[model samples]
Target: MAELESPKMMPKSITFLSSLLQRVADSNDLHREFQPQKISVFHGLTRPTISIQSYLERIFKYANCSPSCFVVAYVYLDRFAQRQPSLPINSLNVHRLLITSVLVSAKFMDDMYYNNAYYARVGGISTIEMNYLEVDFLFGLGFNLNVTPNTFHTYCSYLQREMMQQPSLNLAESSLNLGRSLKVHLCFNEDETSHQQQQLAV
Candidate 1:
């Protein structure tokens, strides 16, 4: 199995949400160079109208999951990318990739999570597609879902540092505001989220 990983990186104080957003934005920035055929072969679509930020916001609003799940999802995406370079993140496949990663992360990290059908509805994909994505993602990941405490802490600390270095921006403000409204907590302070996760892990 591939080793567990974290987001390619951000400063120490970077909120997991912001780091994840930056990661997707970086992928989208490089989307132009990706071959269309590669995306279509996996996602069955060649273009995504919805932005990664907006789609992640939707998941946060509806999934009502812990913020840690997003960090784990980012890790899963990194693993997926490392394991399957041919299916790199691009405009066409990123949405589906995000959805699948988050779903898998939630299942692996959270005890109470929506099932595949529910995730499909949330992701705007068919149940069949969601199931297929889940299977494919698991295979691609070599089913390495166990993230150690040290690795998890490493990711959290990295994200926190990144948050510290980044300047406040409208996107961060709006995203945090929306996250607050949705009651989907994005922990700028890692302590609370890490505590909860540790409790759950026990």
Candidate 2:
């Protein structure tokens, strides 16, 4: 559909987008050195709120996933779909987008693709097709698929650690805390720094 022209010129979404991001950084207890381009925005007309991924998230939500992964995939696909030669083509399959997005995210974040069966072995789904989906997945993310929730998690962990002097707890809390700390390492950029530096930063 055509965007209806309003009575007068309206402020660009970027203006408000910048303010929203500033608020986010403030909420996360981070410095304001970040800019809007340093972040990404989710786009529209995605799979309805009542979708398969939504149901799965309700049942079993991973801290690094469930919500974050699905939201990221939705945004990436929307960005690409809008850039297409056509407006609202609706050519991409939502299920395929979700599957491949999660798969790509797995590779980017944790180096885990435990769903190899779903990608390459399930019901005669060939390995070649899985490879195709991988490339397509990258394409959907505008060929800049470096994002992973782990990155966000890493930042959050560092802040929490800095805020506390000595957070004391028992065995279970230790385990949970360790798991949570590991989640923070998700933001470390392998390409930008030595894996050792990632350890030092987080």
Candidate 3:
């Protein structure tokens, strides 16, 4: 089999993307950064009510696409942001961009998957709106959706490292929280209580 090609990157493109994500997460006042003239007037009207993390989590839970599709979607998002500086990943456009990127990624990576209308339902948008967003997102990405296994692994590893570096809840705090939650289940029989605890562990 022929080797797959990877997208080119600058010296600090990944770092830049990471910082940009931190900025987005740290601040919600994006409307001030970008002028109304820069974005589609309609996007201002169609701003997402939910956080980007929540929206992406919803897609991951329902889309049923390969895990790699998410990594590819991230790549596509980065490319789109780089190419279209004016349309930053702000509150107004993140949800649409997320849906379009994930849809395109699933189409590119999965041999069998849902159609646009199905994805539209998953994304809480109309079929017509989903179609329009897909087209505009593709153009913004310059239709460069190809992602090699190497690039995918690189991104995945980068994300994993970032996750590992973040501070986690200590065992004492976790145990205290778990103990509080288990107090509510004292009424159940032993077997039922054990089963419920198992489910909670999962």
**TM-scores, in order shown?**
0.67, 0.36, 0.66
Find the 10 residues in a row with the least total lDDT in model 3. 180-189
| Cα lDDT tens digits for candidate 2, 1-202 | 2222432221222122222222222322222223122111121234234443332232122222333443344344434443432212121133344455556655555534455445444212366766776675576446776544444454434334533533332322332455422111122343453455567778
RMSD of each: 12.2, 17.1, 17.9
Which regions of candidate 3 fall more than 4 Å away from where they truly are?
A: 1-31, 34-37, 41-47, 167-202
Best by TM-score: 1
Model 2 error, position 185 (Å): 28
Residue 89 displacement (Å), model 2: 7.3
Q: Where in model 2 is the C-alpha error above 4 Å?
A: 1-67, 85-92, 120-125, 148-202
Give lDDT tens digits, candidate 1, residues 22-105.
Answer: 544454445445433244334644566776666777677667567788778877776676567566565567778788888999
lDDT of 3 at 167: 31
Query: Residue-wise lDDT of candidate 3 within 1-202, one digit each (tens)?
Result: 1222542222232333334343442332433543332564216475567755556666766677877777788778777766765665656666777788889999999998889998888888889999999898889889988765555656666566545563342322332354421111111233454466568679
lDDT of each: 0.64, 0.38, 0.61
Better of 2 and 3 by TM-score: 3
For candidate 1, what is the TM-score?
0.67
Q: Model 2 — TM-score against the truth?
A: 0.36
